[model samples]
Structure formats: structure tokens, C-alpha cells
Target: MKQGVQGSPGKPVAARVPAQARPAADGGPYRERDASVRGEHTHEERPGAGQRATVQRSSVRGQILDALRTALATGELKPGEVHSAPVLGERFGVSATPVREAMQQLALEGAVEVVPNRGFRVVERGARELAELAEVRALLEVPVMLRLARTVPAERWTELRPLAEETVRAAAMGCPAGYAESDRAFHRELLALSGNEQLVRIADDLHRRAQWPPVRHGRADLVADAAEHMALLDALAVGDLDVVRGLMGEHFAGTG
Candidate 1:
């Protein structure tokens, strides 16, 4: 597994593992490319689902990775929090092998740290590290927002607004988990608008990392966040590049 940024309760840390950046489904050094052999897919092979069939195997690994990612992003696994293989295995309803395997992948991806005898721990980013990530986002994402401003499909916003609204409402209700998922969905949809898969993936990883910190207790405040999203939607309607860029920047910066 690739190593991610490491933070202590009292110290800031950032360590990234290279292999973690590869598709999570295929992250482990021992991963086989074929999903059927891995028992990740059970459907009988069809004639024309060639590529689709192969992709399905990767889907299990992806689901496992996503589950871990979501757990980390939502602060369910706080920075430096350690979870044993047996515990995680039981929770996920798999054997320790896959759980251990998944942790290794996360470690490679810079999401966790592994010790010789101790189990895996979720990585933590110190305030400074968090700021650095925000800077990176500001640099890479702001331009994408500009591109989106120029090219976004008029009808796409309609599809996006509801999700954003739902996110805001979830946050308002102090439903951190729901709100976080909605928030992720909101940005993922925005990235979809940009129509750049690579860019979207990078942005997603960054956004997921940003959400590592737990939300403060403020249901009313989250309600206000809904307003913030609505404001961005309005900017989208008018093609206000400046507002779009500004709001997105503020949104990410606030996460840190």
C-alpha cells in the first residue's frame, strides 16, 4: 500500500505512497487483473461485455477502496486512528486477507500508515499540510472552473442543483455523513461537467482528503452552507466565472 500524509494528534505530517494513486481496484502488488478469478464478479460471461466484464472485477476493489475512502473522508476513521485487521474484516464481512490487502492498498495511496507489529492507521494531515492541499486545489481546480464556465451544458445545472440542495439540507440537519456524501456527489457532478476524467479523479481525491476533518456541531450553520451552494448555482446560471471560481476556492479553503 502507498503511504499517505501522516499527522499526529500534536504534529502535522504528510507522506504519500506512489502505488496508491493507481486505480484502487488494482492497487495491491498481488492484485490479478482478472476479476472473475478474484471472485469479484459472478455473472456468466456474455459475448459483447468483454471490456465491461473485466471492469466489473475491478469494481469490487473499487467498492472496498471507496468504503475506506469514505470512512476516512467523513472522519469516521480520524487521523492516526488505528483499526485491527480482524475488526475491519468482520465489519466488511470479508476475511482478514482482503481487509489486510485493502489496508495495504490504502497505505500505498497515502491514506494510511502501517507499522511492523501494529495495524494500519488512517493518515492525518496537519493544519499546514491541509493548507498545502488547499493551495494545490486552488491552482488546479480554479482553471477547470473557468473551463466549465465556458462550456457547461445549460441543462446540466438542472440535474446538479437538486443534489447540491440535498447536500446543504443534510448538512443543515447536522447529518455529517449524509452531508459529506452529498458534498462529494456535488463536486463529482461538477467535475463531470468539465468532462475530464483525469481531472475529475484528481479533484475527487483532493476533495476527499479535504473532508477528513470532522464537521463542527452547527446544524444552523450548515443550513447557511445550503445558501452558499445555491449562490454558486446562481453564478452558474449567469456564467459568472469570477463567482464560480471564488466560491469554489472559499469552499475548499473553509474545509481546512
Candidate 2:
């Protein structure tokens, strides 16, 4: 039998369980990792002045991608196991075509591998690769965030406090997916203050991929991580570039 969420401590890997992977003691459906983040944080996107069809297509794609990400995050579809497109299609209440397409996108992101005649396998990453990913994200994010911390008005940073707190609430509630989504919202909104769409999107992707290490055996780290977001804003509020720089470094380091 596949290990439900975690394998033996010696391996530190997760594998696929049956569709009915038992919930934790909290009555949640799955272990609280990416338990259900995207589903919790709803985004309101209105169709633009025109191009309704285009907007609809994008929205559908977004939903499929979110579902796939959740499955991967929650360990519903585990690393090193091949999963067929139709099975995922059924899980997300979508058609196989879109699931296949989304898996292809994940393949490009190094999150999965396309298996000829089989479908796709979640990509298993090692500690070295995770560290490398962290380095790349820090290199892309740290400099920009530092500049923004000093240049952006203090009041603007204050605006992001609630989102940070929301992350803690989600984590406390054992909603990994919710925490992931809110955490993304908090960071994306914070980065948006930089007025650079490309940077925001890039950092957002890295943050999602570099999920904050979960509470392996307790909730202390989860609460601590949530507080870190607020502390970061506090640093920015004081216009302390040195403190902001230090916080940014430590924050990025913790992701790996």
C-alpha cells in the first residue's frame, strides 16, 4: 500500500494513496498541505470591455491548473507515480482534454513529466534541486523587494497586513491549500506594489512551487511563518532597508 501522506522517515517522500485517502483528525478530507487553498480564496475576474470568449477560456484554464496544483500539493497525486489524464479529469470535474493540456504546462514547469501512452508523472525533486530553486527565486525576488520596501510608501505596506494574517488563520485551521492561496495573495499583492507585472508573476510562481515547509510534527513553524509576513511589512513600515534586506534573505532561505 502507498503511504497516505508521508512515507518512512528514512526516505522523506510521499506516494499516491487510494482516492479515499483518509483525513486527519480534524475532519478535513486530506492531510493539511495544499489541502484546499485555491478553493478557499476566490478571485473575482470580470470579463473585459470585449473578448468574452477569450476570458472564459482563460478562466477555465485557470480552474484546471488550480485543481491540478492542489492535487499535487495535497499529495492526492504524488510524486514518482504516473497518473492518467482521465483520472484527474474526473477528480476535478473537467474533461480529459484540458487536464492533459494543463499537465503539459506542468511538464514545462518541471512539476511533472509526460509519460508516453501513460499520461504524466509528478516530478520528484530532491533537496539540491529545491535549494537551487530557492536560490533562483531569491535572486529574482530579493533585490526587487528591497527596492520596493524603501521606495514604496509605508502606508501601502500597511495595506498588506490583513492578507498576511489570513495566511496564519488558514494554516491554523489546517487548510494547506487555503494557506498557499492566501500566502500567494499576500506576496503577489505585496510585489504588485512594485508596479511590475512580470516580476509579480514570476515571484508568485516560485513561491507556489517553493511551498513553505509544512509543520512536520507541530504547528509552531506554521504560526511562525504567518507572523513572518507581518513582521516583513513592519520592517517596511519603518523604512528600514537593512532590516528589510535581512528579513527578505531569511524568508527566502526558509522556503527551501
lDDT of 1 by residue, 27-131 (tens): 333233345666774334456755653454355445556666656655657776677765564455433454577778878667788966768877777889788
Q: lDDT per model, in order?
A: 0.64, 0.65
List CA RMSD, all candidates: 9.6, 11.3
Task: Report model 1's TM-score to 2 decimal places.
Answer: 0.67
lDDT of 1 at 252: 68
Residue 183 in model 1: lDDT: 77
Deviation in angstroms for 161 in model 2?
1.2
User: Which parts of model 2 are misplaced by more than 4 Å?
Assistant: 1-62, 90-94, 212-218
Q: lDDT tens string, model 2, 1-256?
A: 2321223443322233222222222222223233366455422224452354344444555667676666565555566878786665545444455567778888876678988998887777777767777799878877878888768888888888888889889768765666667877988888788889998988877776676233122356566677788888998888888887888777767671
Off by over 4 Å in 1: 1-74, 90-94, 215-217
